[model samples]
Target chain A: MPPVVKIEEIHKIYDSGEVPVHAVRGVTLEIERGDFVALMGASGSGKSTLMNLLGCLDRPTRGRYLLDGIDVSQLDRNALADIRNQKLGFVFQGFNLLARTTALENVELPMLYGARKFTTKQIRERAMHCLDIVGLSQRFDHFPSQLSGGQQQRVAIARALVNEPQVLLADEPTGNLDTRTSAEVMGVFQKLNDEGITIVMVTHELDIAHFCKRNLILRDGVMVRDEAVSNRSFAATELEKLSSAEAAAKLTGAKT
Target chain B: MRFGSIIKVALRALMRNTMRSILTALGIIIGVGAVIAMVSIGNGAKAQVEAQVASLGQNVITVFSGSMSSGGMRGGWGSSPSLTIEDAEAIEREVTGIVGVSPEVRDRNQVLANGLNWNTSVNGESPDYPDIRSWKIASGAMFSDQDVRSVAKVCVIGKTVADQLFANGDPVGQTLRIRNIPFKVLGVLDSKGFNLFGQDQDDAVLVPYTSHMKRLSRRSYISSILIQAASADVIDKVQKDITEVLTQRRKGREPDFTVRNQVELAQTATATTQTMTLLLAAIASVSLLVGGIGIMNIMLVSVTERTREIGIRLAIGAHGSDVLMQFLIEATILSSLGGVIGILLGIGSSQLVSHLNGWPVLVSTASVVIAFVFSAAVGMFFGFYPARKAAQLDPIDALRYE
Candidate 1:
């Protein structure tokens, strides 16, 4: 079977100013089915730009991108939007769940804009199922304001997954969460990956990179490293280790 | 996207800011309300004028003396008493489509009857006078043609004259003294309220033109002539025939009399109110335009305020057209909702005015429909620029918008 995402010599140039800014320079990569990739780079390193290209939020100035074996690099804005709707899901760092909307309604939004028509019943059931997948079934009716930071991120994840997209694109999905909540969110991603859903994440944290199957680093808009994570960290084990460390600290403090 | 979902999304967005939405629609409400109210008031005035014109009698024409240029000194209508009884008789003889003709001589004087005195107009007319003027006889009968020929001292007392002179008894078979000439009352005319000129129609007495000419007015020429056409369709033909016969009788006398039909009188009376209606509607429409501008201003502000929301939608696979449609639908919903409220408000307030002020107000369905459609159109027209701005936003920049 073909890889879910394939790109050859993808380049994005920003000519909005007198100075031409090459944001992404001749980056060639592939993401296989069920692969979890952490696209890592510092600020201004073009990781966000590459992520935008991969998610079809933008088109490359020069490249051939085949998402699910269909060439979408040259598609117009509306066609690209359709491809993004059907083939990709996105989770943002800010937990971009629409304000004042319930978790279930946020999850159901993408389906409302989908090319295929869905009955209200189907939409509700499907949104519920996605919330269930993210362990937020009980919190479906809770609005973003009502949810905690981690719960809100989870709701956003459920929204991303509701369309059943082949590749989930998460841009700093846990950047706002604390260490423990980050692990919990990573655990959810790991669980989704285990269920054979591909995910591509952008994060600057080294420890966060270890949660993925592979890590790619970019420097000056050029790919610098592409390597398997030899010491992969399961969020489940990390969370367990965190709780026990807390328990040991509590015990030590009691003895003192 | 499904149209139903788009509407749902738009309604939800509007409901999210209910206070702002209501404020935004208030402009349209006032605009449409003013339009409806102004038009209704104008229409009401026009209807009242038309009703008064109808009171002048149906299919009737009048020929007033002296709208002529003699020796280069032009005189307005009724300036000089030039129409004579012979002219009225000639029209009655020569005009084919005329039903009746009456020579009229009008005078105002104080009279005594039943040991009481009152000042009122005394009109001298033929036996066809009551029929020509559509005036009804409340009691007793009109004086016969023999009474007119013999210059009988018989008259029909109006209700106002009867009530004033014969306070305790019927005026019929009683006497009313006009210019100190005692004339026996033959009948009493039914009360007709004030005319368009605010003149009380029932505050007068009718006597034969012969008696009025010989005893009261004492002139050879009559003041005017009233002629009733056989039917409405023949009014123009009958008028033309009268003009021809009178012109021939004058024999190059510069056509001293002016002929007028009821239709012309009605048109002249209604023209001012029609202009007022149009002017009021025009002014009202300017306010509506201002209201449209208000909508555009709010929509522009809304687009800016909800930039992040639009970004989220676009990033989540919403097409630009979808965003445009959503905003457009939101504007339409706001304006059309305002339109409905304004229509109800207009009707309510007009009815209130009519009830409170005793002013006639006609609320036409056409005006309501036009106001509604205009409001909706205002929404669409003013909403386009802001909606287009939202639609043209780049998803990448939009998603990144703080």
Candidate 2:
């Protein structure tokens, strides 16, 4: 089977009157199925732009973007949206769950726009299943405001996965979470990846990038490094260590 | 997605800001309410005119003395007593479609009965007067031709006169003195209520033309001639025939009388009422336009406020058409809901006005339906630009919008 995502010489140029900004320039890359990859870059390094292109939210200025053997660079906006709905899932840094909506409703949103007609009952069941996978089954009726930052991110992840998209694109999924919560979120990603769902995450944190099996470094809108993570961190083990360390710190403070 | 689910989504979004939604819809509410109320008032006025015309009798024609111009001073129609009883007789005999003719002479006189005096109109009419005027005696009987020939002082009192003179007691067979002449009340006429000009129709007493000509006005000429046509379809022809016969009798030297039909009078009255209705509806529609503008303004603000949400939806696979449809549905729902509330308010207020002011009001179903559909169309019309603005937003940039 062809790689899930393949980009060849993709360029994104933003025109603002007199000055043209080259947000993404001639980036070529490919990701195989089940590859948990982290895209690491500093601010203004075009990682977000690259993620947008991969998610079919934008068109490249002059390049080819093959999402699962389909060239999406020339697709219209509606067709691009259709591909995003059917073949790709996106998780945003802001945990863009609809405000005032329950966790289950937010999770069921993507299925509402899916190409496959899903009955309301089926949508509910699938949403519940995805929420269960993210360990948020108990928070189904809780709104975004009622959920903690970690739980909100988990709800957003469940929303992304409800349609069963092939590749999950997460843009700084744990950027707003505390260290322990971040590890817990990463553990969900690890579990999803183990179940054969490919994930490409964009993060600036080196420690978070270490959780992925591979890391691609971007600098000044150019790919600088693409290498396997020789020392991959297991998120479940890290979360365990974090909880024990917090427990020990609390005990020592009490003794003092 | 199915259309129902799309509407469901829109309803959910609107419910999130329930207060704002209701406030925004208030404009349409007032607009539609004003429209319905104004239309109902107009309809009521028209119906009142129709009832007045019907009371004037079906297919009845009147011949009034034409305007009298003396020394550049022009007097209105019926100013001169040019119409005579001879003219009425000639029309009755010569006109083929004439059903009945009555020569009328009127005077305002003080009438006394039961030791109480009331000033009212006293009219002299032929025995055929009741038939021509479409009036019926409520009790006793109308005077016959023998009474008219012998100039009997018997009179028929209208409801208003009877009530003024006798109160609850029956006026029939009672003696009433008109202008110091004691006249026996032969009967009481049924109530006719108010005419189109808001004048009381039941404030008169009818006597024989011979009695009025000899005792009351003491005039040989009649004020006007009332003629009933054979049927409604022949009123125009009968009026023309009267004009021809009168013209021939006057030797065609600027005919002295004017022939008029109730149909024409009714048309004129209804036309005036219709013009008033249209003017009121037109003025009320301006508020509906303003309401539409209010919708557009609020929708624009809503689009801006929910830009990020729209981007998120678009990014998640919602087409631009979907976003557009969602906003459109939201606006339509708001205005339609407003329409329903306004219809109820309009009906309530119209009834309230009718009850308080005693003005006739009719809430037509067509007006309600028109106002509702117009409000919904206003929603769709005004909602387009804002929905299009939202639909045209780039998902990537919208996602970054604050």
Highest DockQ scorer:
1
Clashing pairs in 1: none
Model 2 regions more than 4 Å off:
A247-255, B67-76, B79-86, B93-99, B108-120, B145-154, B163-171, B174-184, B194-200, B210-220, B230-234, B248-251, B267-283
**Maximum-TM-score candidate:** 1
| Residue-level error in angstroms, candidate 1, position A197 | 1.4
In model 2, pairs of residues that clash are none
Query: How well is each residue in B110-133 modelled by candidate 1, as lDDT tens digits?
Result: 979877899999899999988887
lDDT of 2 by residue, B1-402 (tens): 569878988898789889988888888898898889989999998998898899998889889988888999999988876887888888888989887889989889999988999999999998898888788889989999999999999999899998888997888888999888999999989998998788899999999998999998899888899999999888888888999999988885888778889988999989988999999899888988888888899899999999999998999999999899988988898888888998898889989999999999999999999999999999999999999999999998888899
Go through the candidates in order and give each one's DockQ.
0.72, 0.65
